[model samples]
Target: MNGQPQWQPISMLPVFTDMIDGMLESSLEQLQNMQAVKDKPHVLDDSILGRVIALYSEQLQNHGAFQEQFNRWKKTGLCATDLAEVERLIQQLAKLKTANETILGIAKSISHATIDKIMAMDDAELAVAFLSGKLKRPI
Candidate 1:
């Protein structure tokens, strides 16, 4: 696998744009395959399944958009309670591959920066920074 991306806080917005682009591109390919199947005759059950998949894909895109916006909003700084919620969302997201909500929360946290920023901080500093309006909103 490739190594991790280098830290570049200022480059975050562009990075997010690229990531979303990549995701949409890949998702479109998967969607095309799904549609090819749907083009065939199907019972109501299969159609329902296809619809569910479509909804999931749309949700994924929505999460991406929210993450970008969240990063932007975070620049306004977070309240203590809001920071706690973000943390909770992060923890919940880490354990699941498809937990889009959780993932989006965490992603939003680092949207304007890199994971290193979060990892380098002690809880107190992180909390203080978050509550002080020093952080940026992402997404």
Candidate 2:
């Protein structure tokens, strides 16, 4: 419902944070590998790219939602541990962004206009774009 609070229970915050951390870390590793092999004559794996896109999409959504909810939670007063967890998530998201930029640079396939459009897209739109084959391998 629109009026419902989107925040998760405090008890579950760590679990969600951990899941997100793992996903971001995995995606970064995959992206780094892709970068390492960019000079080779290997064919890009669509499945792996798709997985990275999916994970990145999910991470963006979760990060946005968590940040919004955390802002609201802050107004209600949060404990130090909660604050630290949110900060950690924020830092991880930054790493994800850097990794994404590096991979984008390696790809050199996406146009500036498409990059702008992708940057403006929400999670669902990103997923749809990927599914529609708007994003492909050339990186």
Candidate 3:
């Protein structure tokens, strides 16, 4: 067989599993943090807001990566072990999906509240609020 191995290469299922676990944990932490400030978005600091946006972006990227990895794994012949891992990953993904939705909802409510506050302000008030750091420019 020349120098090539006769068997197929090892599966990457474990690596994918670990990655998903970490993502799930991070997502859950984000969800908890968002819940704490859901009722009072104005209290959120710039760092927290930036982190939320970053988490959302990371989720999108991770989703695409997962899909690509799944497709490639399927092409290599899935066994029972692989199927089990895939199912677990799917369940974790579902939880992540729920968390992401809640996070977005909280973000939406915060945006609405901020907009209402801005709408009630006069031009002079708006300028003062902006200058005083009560209002932030859109990212």
Candidate 4:
């Protein structure tokens, strides 16, 4: 009723696949570099340094998992590792999408409802509105 309707968010596939690849590759390179440094003192000045490095690398490996999650999310609209997490993320994403559509529907309905309320006026009110050039043109 004012200007153009507000734009809605569409389900757009990500435009940059290279971005995801670059992010994961950079993350992995950083992890390996750190691991290499951590491994240097092992079997020489300190055994604990090596063991600690091993544990650290183990944690670093989980970053690859984030990339895996990104892949699953792109393919299935859900990013889940185990069945349980899959179910939960699917349910959450479903609820989120549903809520979005619901809000959009509400806005559309409200626009229609406002027009209906205007046209439901009694004969006298309609006459006065029309005579005063206040009635909207039918599209």
Clashes (backbone N, CA, C under 3 Å), per candidate, total: 18, 1, 0, 0
How much is 8 displaced in model 1, in angstroms? 26
lDDT of 4 by residue, 2-106 (tens): 234232121222322343334344444544443343322111222333343344344334334433453454456432343445444444434433343333333
Worst 10 residues of 3 by lDDT: 1-10
Local distance difference test, each candidate: 0.45, 0.60, 0.68, 0.40
Q: Judged by TM-score, which candidate is best?
A: 3
User: Could you give candidate 3's per-residue lDDT for residues 93-112 as a string of tens digits?
Assistant: 77877787778777655763
Q: Which regions of candidate 1 deviate over 4 angstroms?
A: 1-44, 90-139
Better of 2 and 3 by lDDT: 3
- Candidate ordering by TM-score (highest first): 3, 2, 1, 4
- Model 4 residue 80 lDDT? 38
Model 3 stretches astray by more than 4 angstroms: 1-10, 111-139
Backbone-clash count (model 1):
18
Give the better candidate number (1 or 4) by lDDT: 1
Q: After superposing candidate 4 on the true structure, give the runs of residues whose Cα lies further than 4 Å from its correct spot.
A: 1-82, 112-139
Give the C-alpha lDDT of model 3: 0.68
For model 2, name the residue pairs that clash.
107-139
